[model samples]
Target chain A: MPSLKDVKTKIGGVKKTSQITKAMNMVAAAKLRGAQSKMEAFRPYAEQFHAAMASLSAGTGGARFPLMEVREVKKVELVVVTSDRGLCGSFNANILKVANRAVAELEAAGKKVSLVCVGKKARNFFRKSGKMRKDYIDIMGTFQMFNARAIAQDAAANFLSGEADEVRLIYGRFHSVALQRPEQTTILPIKPIEGEAGGAAAPASQAVYIYEPSQEEIMEVLLPMFLNVMVYHSMLEVSASEHAARMTAMDNATRACKDIINNLTLIYNKTRQAGITSELMDIVGGAEALKG
Target chain B: MAALIQLEIVTPKGAVLSEQVEMVTAPGYAGVFGVLANHAPLLSTIKIGNLVYKKDGRDDIVMVSGGFCEVSNNKVTFLVESAERGSDIDVDRALRAKERAEKRLAEAMAQKEKIDRVRAEAALQRALARLKAAGKM
Candidate 1:
């Protein structure tokens, strides 16, 4: 049988664990708010960028930009974004699994697969897996747009130089504090959207635009800008999702710790009561024997 | 027709300016140009310079780096690489940036390397824009 002191020590240890987990949960919650706001603020920029592109392409006589060229899939580059640290439950694991599956699927189709890992977790995994083109680690300690721009520039350079014919991004999309879903989006070789009318000279909006320099010049600048917007949005989403995942994971740990402490406290109290009762019974038996 | 147009200057960080303005004059790559309400639907790439806007008979200055601007339906949106308000800019920081860019340019010229000229020129423009906006130049 365990002694009363042993039960007491176990309860103390469990209580300490509860405190630590509770602190971690609070910290994660604070970080989540900042990340979520950053993600929210980026939506307007992305939407505006898309709207601009839509009207620009329509107004530009629908000339095919170089980034929008569709070519046979010879080589593909997968830009995988994962968390730098691990305490966030299955956040990193889930994203890494999906990325690996994508790579495998692409390879099976006879297309060469290369990775541009944006986080430490992804870098480590791809380093072991084989054929990692670039690993961007420890750059996202704080979310910055220039970081996104740098990555987008590399991806665009690869596509333009024919080093990689196709480019895709994989990251976790934040839905709410309780839910985050891993998502994949193709960014290279821009997909042509259906103009308002079916290949008509003028779109339905029919908004005749007067180009300052020329229509072609605007598209040339906007295409790469659009790519940068996409990458920045993805980075913000992943950052928010990581914080949310960490918050949920820490919350669960805190609850589990509380339950453990409760159980340990019950055992400790019962053990102490039993010890007290045994001492009283021994004293009573001795007094009764002396009276006899 | 609205006398004023909604001008929103947006950067990667967030929206720097979103207000109804009487007019907006930005530094276009072709040259400096002004936009008013009911302007034609147009798109132009802007260079690093001061973007001036008028509101309530008062003028506001914003510094924007290279980006694009879209005008449609009485609204002008500036999708810039970076932007800062004249009131928010630190003059000393802009001066320091100017010095750093000039030094980099001189070094590149000395080494016979054309690689950093483009970047150095851009940096110089950005610093000058900030200085001009802050009224330090």
Candidate 2:
């Protein structure tokens, strides 16, 4: 049996640990709010970009844009986005798992797969593999649109230069605070927005548009902008999802720590009571012997 | 006929403005143009300059960097890299930016650096647009 002093020391250690976890839980909650607001703020920009692209592409009348050309798939670049820091309970691991699975699947199909890791966790995970085309490290905490623009530009360059025939992005999609799932999307070879023809059937959509400079010039700018929007959207999603995952994980840790502290406290109280009872029994026995 | 059009100025950060306005005059790549209610469908790339819209006969100026504007269905949407209202422009910040860009340009000219010269020129243009929008230029 452990001594009462030892039990007390253990209880103190557990209490300190619980306090740290509780503090971490609160920090995560606050950070989650900021990240979620950032995600909400980006939606308007993305929506406006899409609406502009839809109308522009509808007027193009099947002009062959270089970014839209689909070529034979010889090489694939997987852009995996994850959190820069860990302790978020399987958030990074799930993304890496999905990414690895994609790489394996692509390799099995007789295509070369290269990685474009977007966070430190992904960089470290794929560091030893030697298949990295590029690894962007330590940008999650303060990522901006320029960061996404840079990544998209690199991916576009690779595709245009024939280094990679295709590019795909994998990120954790935030559905709610309690749910996030890994999602993959193809960002390259910019597909013509589906339902373009159907939209023209509407009466209001049939109006002729006066294009400035020219349609082709606007399209030339629009396609690249579309790619940038795709990358930026994914980055925003990953940022929000990371925070939610961390909040939930920290909350669970705090609760578990509380339960541990409760159990330890119960044991400490019992041990102290037992010591008091034994001392009382010894005093009573000594008094009875004196009376005899 | 409706006398007002919906004007929305959106950046990657968020929508800066979304309200009904009497008219909008933007700095288009082709040239500066105005849009009223029921204007024809149009799409144009914009430059770094001041944008003005009249609401209740009050002209509200906004500064926008290079982006595009789409006019459709009585709506004018500007998707720019960044934007700021005339009232939101911090004169001190704009002044500092102008000074920094000027210094960079001077240094680039002395060293004959083409890339630095180009970036500095763009920065100078943005700062000038901000000042011009605030009517301090």
Candidate 3:
């Protein structure tokens, strides 16, 4: 059994650790608030872009753009976005798990798969497994639209040059502070919804738009922009989710540390009381023996 | 009497301005273009420069980077890469940025790097736009 002094020292160390975790939790909470606001600020732009695309696709004949071309799925490139840093609970692991599942499914179907990891964590995770073809790091914390544009351009160039058969983006979608779900979305070869092509009759009335440039020209410009914006938005979501997850994890760790400290304090008190009682009993017995 | 036009200026960050205005003058790709109420439907790429909007007999200036402008149905929308209101722009910072871009441009030319030169030129334009909007140029 450990001595009381050792237990007391351990309790002190645990108390210090709990203090540190509590500080970290507060910092994470502050950062999470900032990230969440940023994510919210980006939502309007994404929604507007999507609405514009939906309206445009509804107005024009479907599959008129090269990007809308559905090709055979022989090779798939997955762009997995995760945080560069860790300590954010399972934020990175969940994304990797989803990507692994995707890889397995693709491989089973005799399709080759390549990875375009966007963060250090994802890059490092897949690098050891020799699964990543290319990786970008150190951009998640300070993400910018230019970064997204460059990445989207590279992916588009690869797809256009027939280097990859298809492109899909996998990332964690932030639903709330308590919930984030892994999502996989197709990035290339825009798919039109059903009953909307060739002026097909649908439940809702389709509005006609006067395309300034040809539909093909608009698509040529808009498709890449759409992809970049979508990717940027996803990055923002992941950032917010990471902060949220970190805040929650740190809070839980801090609480656990506190509980441990409390238990240790109780044990230390009991042991100290037992030692004092035993010393008193020895003194009384010595006095009684003297009297005898 | 001129009709009221709904003008919205949006950046990647968020919507900067959305209000009814009397007129708007924006720096177009070709040149500076002014739009009033009942203007024809037009779509054009915008260059890095000042955007002046007249609302309620007051003129509000905003510095904008390259993006696009769409005018349709008497509503004008400027989707800019980045924008800052005239009141928000810092004149000293703009001057410093301008000087930095100029120095970078010279260095790029000396090094014979076309990409660096292009980026420096863009930075210079953006800085100049901010200064002009702030009435420092």
TM-score of chain B of each: 0.96, 0.95, 0.96
Per-residue lDDT over A1-292 for candidate 2, one digit per residue giving the tens place of the 0 to 100 score: 5687887888788778878877877887888888888878888888878867776776776698878879999999999999998988888999999999999999999999999999999999999999998989877777577788789888998999999988999999999989999999998888877444568563266467788979889988778878888888888888888888888888888788778878878888898889899999999999999999
Stretches of candidate 1 exceeding 4 Å from the true structure: A194-207, A288-292, B111-115
Candidate 2 CAPRI classification by DockQ: medium
Q: What are the candidates' C-alpha RMSDs?
A: 2.5, 2.7, 3.7
Q: What TM-score does candidate 3 get on C-alpha atoms?
A: 0.86
Best by lDDT: 2
Give candidate 2 misplaced runs (Cα > 4 Å). Answer: A196-204, A280-292, B102-121
B45-116, model 2: which lDDT tens digit per residue? 998999999999889999999889989889999999899999999988999999999999999999999978
- Model 1, A1-292: lDDT tens per residue? 6897888888888788878878888888898898877777777878777766776776665587889888988999999998888889899899998998998899999999989999999998889777898988887658777788889988999999999999999999888889998999999998754444544644644557767678788888878878888888888888888888998998899888888888888887888889899999999999999999
Sort every candidate by lDDT, greatest first: 2, 1, 3
TM-scores for all candidates? 0.93, 0.91, 0.86
How much of the true contact map at the interface does candidate 3 reproduce, as a fraction? 0.21
The order of the candidates by TM-score, greatest first, is: 1, 2, 3
Docking class of 1: medium
Off by over 4 Å in 3: A193-215, B27-33, B39-47, B90-128, B131-137
DockQ, each predicted model:
0.70, 0.75, 0.34
**Candidate 3 lDDT for residue A174:** 88
* Residue-level lDDT tens digits of model 1 in B14-61: 898999999999999799999999898877899999999999988889
